[model samples]
Target: MSGAGNDAAAPPLAGIRVLDLTRLLPGPVATMQLADMGADVLKIEDPGAGDYARAMGPVRAEVSQFFVAVNRGKRFLRLDLKDQAQREQLLALVDDADVLVESFRPGVMAKLGLGWDVLRRRKPTLVMCAISGYGQDGPFAQLAGHDINYIGYAGMLANNAGPDGTPALPNLQVGDLLGGAQSALQGILAALLAVKMGGPGRFVDISMSDAVLAHNIMPLVAVNNGAEAAPARDLLTGGVPCYNVYRTADARFMAVGALELKFWQLCCDVLQRPDLKARHWQLGQQVGGADALAVKAELDAIFAGRSLAQWTETFAASDCCVTPILTSAEALRHPLFQARRMVSQERHPTEGVYWAVAHPIKFET
Candidate 1:
């Protein structure tokens, strides 16, 4: 309750203390979001080798850039949970912590004698979040898995494909980020709110696979309606000509999201193909049907006639929901991100100037 007084300028999570036992991506990024909002996040690592991410990917000044990017704005500590003395020390720290987030397998924390039952007996108001590939007490709870496995289990991987209908591995870790991190964030915040209202603390069990499965909404809708949810044959998944990716003469890609008829008409106008506007999904043109594929092929040929840069310029002023597919490096330099300050450089003590992605949340004060 340090900064819980009525102060308009104080950060939202100013008084919150978070004990982070998570390493690598999902758990670390979740706590980092809290830290960005002025929570005091203490990332506790084992005294042995510490977080494996410290050695993952490219290194700069003896630290992994991957680790540096996700673990910014947090304090660090090391303790060996196996040792009684160190375990006692962690328990003492837990006494002062408002929240604890961990990403271990289901039974590891219970085996450590630091399970939710023990912690809740000691402190009833402590919110604990457990993040894992599968939910606690599930058939796959004890099984080891990663982002790819989780998304595949959630039925998302099957739908993420191209015209060839082969499942494509996405560069974005949707299962890890959306499923684990964001879901845990939501649970933690809701539990914190409940505690603020004088309720007992809650245990948040986050399963990456379960989360992604819950969010794979469109395909589920189709299945519930007794329709087939085929790969690359769904409305949002390259099934419709108006919402597909097209390759340009330079082999670069453009994302078209002209789903609505208005946007489709605008896109047709920009492409100088007014005749194509009548063949929209709303108008009896079946999605993933022969007509739709023919229209997509026609659009593809038209797009391949020009360079990506030329198409980008052609659609710059049109509100047709068409945009060039930018690489990660190009996205960092894009004017949209620049204007919003999404990416900024922070001087790490050892790593020098490293790029940091700003928290997307904004508060007016």
Candidate 2:
């Protein structure tokens, strides 16, 4: 909806055709990015249920808000893959599609007679991307998993914890969004580029677990150095005072990311605790050590002495990477997003006006 007309102003993917046979969050979001970039995305669903997300969450007007959020700017069609006639119809669509994205279990497509081999043989230039929990051929290929399961298996859950050492559930679906959607998008773009360069079409295999594991970098570094990555104790976690979260007087939280020595020094000066500047990580103070904990406790007490508003005003002019933890509603009204044009309102046929997030990437003509 953002960029659909005028050849000069059309988005980069204007002429590309994408056949999306995915459902739920990850795959739909992936294709939604394509739709945002002006790809002609056609979403195919089974005749019986279509996308399960249509009934998964709160219904606004007649359709699910979850479905409408990720399924914008796409043409929809229903065809039961089990039916021979419907399967053939899908193939006909595929013949003209530049990219095909699916998120079924590894062998399900083959069982439905629409596997990558069949597709590639039919159209050698087609880029096929398959997103699964594990991978196409792996021990856990047949296993069922959600975002939590994938992140847990990748050791990400263990590292994400609080002072109590209990793994906190994040509202963001890391595995589904990062591992599935982002990984699939990266592969699809790369494959499309390869095809455009006159190379044979590539089959993109996206394993959510694999992607999660690959990105768990900091922990892997510790493991490679022959040390265990303790929960809630890593440098980037809550181990140090320079980069941690503190509670304010009103029970609100503030995120402190003054990782650099200069920023830490400035933060200490703002807190009127210049004495604490010497006890920094760069000054050879061991992270998560007793001294670090003591410093964190002192800063925690200081932060709790003031309300969030008082602290915000106190650090208004400082550039120490300190910020108040804002809720989603607050973020929507924040000046940063408003100035960036990251949020917009669209009127659905029946749902009236709904807020939508614009694609983050920007291109200058």
Deviation (Å) of 225 in candidate 1: 2.1
Q: Per-candidate TM vs. native?
A: 0.96, 0.97
Which window of 10 residues has the lowest lDDT sum in candidate 1? 1-10
- Residue ranges of candidate 2 with Cα displaced over 4 Å: 1-8
Expressed as tens digits, the lDDT of each residue in 296-335 for candidate 2 is: 9999999999999999988989999999999888888789
What RMSD, rounded to one decimal, does every model reach? Answer: 2.7, 2.0
lDDT of each: 0.92, 0.92
What lDDT, from 0 to 1, does candidate 1 have? 0.92
User: Candidate 2: what lDDT?
Assistant: 0.92
